[model samples]
Target: MRILQQMNAFCVMTLIAFSISASVQAESPAPVQAAKKALAVGQTAKDFQLLSVGGELSGEVKLSDVNADGKVVVVVLRGFPGKQCPACSAQVGDFVKNASKFAAKNAKVLLVYPGPKSQLDQRADEFLQGTKLPAPLTFLLDPGYTFTNAYGLRWDAPRETAYPTTLVLDESGKIQFVKISETHRGRSSAAEVLEAL
Candidate 1:
């Protein structure tokens, strides 16, 4: 009877551990098939200027400004809360960890979140809090998806969200690397973008 009880205790502990691991892995949920159509390498990224949450001044920032003196990593995020998007947040967090690495390689990181202009500033501010993305990172609002439409990241699938993708631009503002998620889950990691640089 003593041996049986010990085995039961061990099984319970094992189950608890597995449960915790799964929760940690869910920091970002992956996107489905429709968000995938990524751009090709060597493509010249279109220039875009967006209004930021820092306060409304229309077109205050240009894509060229972010990628100007170094390489730039453009991250597309699910705009607002139709539902909480764990995957988009996760991908941004992954790149946040490597902000310095990109800096060391003379690169910039741009985090773009698109949604309707209504409540966009509030939503973007909340999303950016505690992300640890410093000066080199530019957080932009694609209000009305002005930038999203230009980039072709609009996912019109039934009940689907925006395209979750990543682009690496060289110093001259030309795309050197591109990662279009086949589903929302498959974003390019910090290591992958670094390797391309």
Candidate 2:
């Protein structure tokens, strides 16, 4: 009878231990995803397709198409956060003013406007109002942050859109220069980007 009682207690303890182990396993959180690396110079530029809600190119714009014919590609702009950014406006204006210079170098400039999914196209159009993008300078819309996330530039903060970035790509689609602004200030000027090209 004593042996039987000992065996029962041992079985009960074993079951409790197993239960605790299972509970711990269930409560443990899943492993976190690794952080995505930011795009940099010397790396091959990742190809992305985005709609041109407004500008010279009012259609789908692909990186491959931009790099076709050995044209240098320049990406310059900030994604719209809560509203249109004055800094972005100034930066784009600078690029537009220098559109002729870009063309001279056989380069194409793409101004990326990123925002949430809600009325993204409408917002992009509103932003483009009163600003004329000449030939070789186009505006791109990043709806729902698809391109932003793919490039690891999603700001993901309140009242913050994507990180202001400028990338210069060579004819072969390799990144020649990359500037990712930590703050709204320090945007790449057209001359600086042209120098990279």
Model 1 misplaced stretches (Cα beyond 4 Å): 1-38, 54-59, 130-132
Model 1: lDDT to the true structure: 0.73
lDDT tens readout by residue for model 2, 53-89: 6556778988888788566555545566777889998
Best by lDDT: 2
Q: For candidate 2, what is the TM-score?
A: 0.78
- For each candidate, what TM-score against the reference? 0.73, 0.78
lDDT of 1 by residue, 1-197 (tens): 99999999999999999999988775433332222333567778889988654321234778777666778788888776475577877877777677678778877777788887788887787777745455556678888878877787766565454677788888887778887764667778889988988
Q: Alpha-carbon error at 67 in model 2, in Å?
A: 0.7
Q: Where does model 2 exceed 4 Å of error?
A: 1-38, 74-76
Candidate 2 accuracy as lDDT: 0.77
